[model samples]
Target: MLDRIDATSITTIQLYNQPFIRAFEMTPSLPTFVPATQLPLAIDNGRLVLQDMLGVGAYGSVYRAIDTQTHQTYAVKSLNKAGLNSRQCAFQNHEAQLHAKVSGHPNIVTLHKVVEENDCLYMVLDCGMEGDLFYTITERGGFVGNTMAIKTIFSQIASAVLHCHSRGVYHRDLKPENIIMFGRSVKLVDFGLATTEPVSSEFGCGSTFYLSPECQGGFIESVKSYDSAANDVWSLGIILINLTFGRNPWKQACPRDETFSAYAQHNDFLQTILPMSTELNEIVKGAFCLNPKKRITLSELARRVQACRFFTTPEFPSEASVVSAATAASQASFSTTMSGVYPTSNLHGPDDKEDSGVDLQSMA
Candidate 1:
């Protein structure tokens, strides 16, 4: 008789190798590009011409291209024809259509058009030349400590999420990698995992680490089973922590047996970042609550952040200042803020309204 491997030993092995396993496990499979025949659009002198490949995903590759006719740059996302053939193309098409519908918001990446060419579906969006927040944070050596600057960025993201929620669009994936920053402005990109209806499956689409607790437990069971806008808020909270700490809060949590529920309830894990500001700590705790109902909504979170000790003071020089003084002050302020000046101001107008008509509704 052959010797049997002990289950307990296996568990211990998995726990010890959890980090490596998670890295491999969360990585999506490579996409299979559709045959050229499925591509319906032709590249001409005055049409679309592929510039460069930006990234690849389980669906397909994203290409940076130029529209010769309009002389405009765009990010063309091509869906793998092979995947489309096996899976539901309707959902992909729906995602593109929904993005097109709400592409007007400043904080949301604008979708120019969609064209089918050679068995591939190509979606054109404004190309962000400044790259994504992930790149910025990485290049800057982790977290940037400009409180006003960070709040400014978060406001833009919050505004986009709120707008999406109001329009019944749920962005299942919200992370720093999906947040593109151009100069001082930021926009939310990628809607591959977005839905206009309620998300019904507990183990639905999302990056593993960013997946909400409810989602990890496989609690979602129906198409209308989504947790409203709070899910996005939770992801945003995680993103905030990442930006603030320069790492994932659950980076040490093993993926094999440490489900999101267990991770959320562990107070020891929560206490790991006790050095963070009380405001930020509270924000993080409130957003990552195990119960979706307990998590604060995007509107409420935005208000809290805006009213926090950040975003109150003026950093840049005003337009009314004289040319020489304004230029000097602007340069100084920019340098100081960029170097890490945490301002404390309640950046709220007299009205202090919650939803300024920006929607964050789910598309599924």
Candidate 2:
């Protein structure tokens, strides 16, 4: 089941502002997500040439590849049938389904196509060359005085998560490792643990450090179900804390854990462990409520993110975006009461030239 077709030199696409919302209205959702074990051999797309191995994981490896004709780079993730169990295979299938369902989201990595080869499933994805948010945290040693940077990254994640939920896809695993960087822009990747339905007791899947309290195995006696959407939000909160503080606040998300325990007790941990901006502080506070029902919904979280007074007020992409040329550029900012530092408006944008002026909104 392999077909090779000549492709044109398709430029790497970048979306900015609200226009990105409807950019892929015609992109079709995939019809099937069959397991690799059942696929025919040599399901490769010969039109794309593989280069270096980008990453290795439990399920498979990702390679940097380029289209032969277009020469555009893509990430090819190979999921071998041997690396997955029946349940894992099913989850993998669901992951492929969910990703195709939300194909054009700017903050979520794009999947160009799927191929099966040598009993392996390959997902061609966006090449995030800057690596992941986790690497940046280690390099920067925390956001430090850059509150605007913190807001921008967190808001992008929040908006993406909310968008997925709205489309009925629950990204059960959301962590720094899963958030890959595309220059100043970030895209959520590795949807191997994602699903279109709620996570049942049968599967409590996520990295321990970023897992929600309800998803913890030891936290509950019998296997139980969880609202994976909340887990996504909770993990995003942890990611925010990690970015702000430069380390894991707690060993785990359990009440018995030191940091989480303190959070459970009058929310002291948030204030005690890390010093952050007021807006970030409140976002973290709402995320660690321990009660899934009370935890801030993604919609509300997004609103709270956009409402930060630090945001100067988003503006249109000005004259540059409207040009017939290949790219568009736009930005806006207002005076801030806090010293000379001004946080640029909007959640996703180009990298800040300096701490004094941070423009987090996207540039077309």
Candidate 3:
């Protein structure tokens, strides 16, 4: 789904996976959806009037809706029997179950409720106006120019992931698109790939570039059992690099990864890539280390990130830049392709312009 709505009038034909559509201009107002009809998507009680289509994927669509009773807005995800397999539909139900298990974490999105009927599924989630981290990164160029802000954002993410792990859960799908922002405050969303078991399945999962070295589910014939917590930490490291550098360090993990190997051969690798402090350098090394056994745990990583000077720095221009970008993101429309929401996605895409720089070898 795309945001092609007219803010002045809340009535617009919902477009699905359209290209070159202009972003929606939204303001605080009630929705005027097309006259009640039995569509694949719709909800009841409190007149849950579905508004703008926030985002759409291969399996389903997320819409902006309003609870007429409270006049409060929410992000509603609809799963229907069009263009989706049974497994994909199951993933949606799995996500709803996971959200129910862990809903009180401050940094994670709260699942308001779920509806079942019309041979479809509707899930109500907290509506975030500021869009997602991917858009913010694009608008800001990269976080390498804003080290303090990067630390600040990463610290929050580390804390959130740590909280998830503490509750015996793991967000297997940790990526920029899944992390929505509301100014400096951030919330983790989209738990379609989340799991409670150490290794949910032998097969691969999550976005390719963000997958842990051990969890190359798609590329490898048989993936070694992976600790979900460690997988999350590795993905978090990739996110830090992606946000700060605006590019992935390599297509895969190291020794095999040429770019990472080159960096490993150097002593000032972390600082060489970006102007990171010595303490921060150590943290980066711990997170990005080729050996997962030596990598820092979520708790340790969160503690270090929260205590870091860059993370604690307040009122800095670099930090303020994120707020500014988020405000812009709030106005612009956000999109999610069918590919993005899938379990196995091409780690390399058009947006990852530097994907060519890394050597993507056979995981087997």
Q: Per-prediction TM-score, please? A: 0.69, 0.69, 0.70
After best superposition, candidate 1 residue 163: deviation in angstroms? 0.6
Can you list the residue pairs that collide in candidate 3? 58-338, 204-217
Q: Highest TM-score: give the candidate number.
A: 3
- Give the per-residue Cα lDDT of candidate 2 at 73: 74
lDDT at 106 for candidate 3?
Answer: 76
Candidate 3: list runs displaced more than 4 Å. Answer: 1-41, 81-90, 140-144, 217-223, 254-257, 263-271, 309-364
Stronger candidate by TM-score (1 vs 3): 3
Per-residue alpha-carbon lDDT of model 2 for 241-322, expressed as tens digits? 6555444555566645544555555464455334445566677778766777799988777678667654211221232232
Each prediction's Cα RMSD? 13.5, 17.0, 12.5
Judge candidate 2 at residue 271 and give its lDDT: 50
Cα lDDT of all candidates, in order?
0.56, 0.56, 0.58
What is the per-residue lDDT of model 1 for residues 129-216, given as tens digits with 9 covering 90 to 100? 6555654444433334456666777889899988888888888778766777655677887786677765545453566556675665
User: What ranges in model 2 sit over 4 Å off?
Assistant: 1-45, 82-89, 140-142, 217-223, 277-279, 309-364
TM-score of predicted structure 1 = 0.69
Candidate 3 residue-wise lDDT, 108-187, digit = tens: 88888889765668878888776566655544333544556676788778778878887777888787767777656678
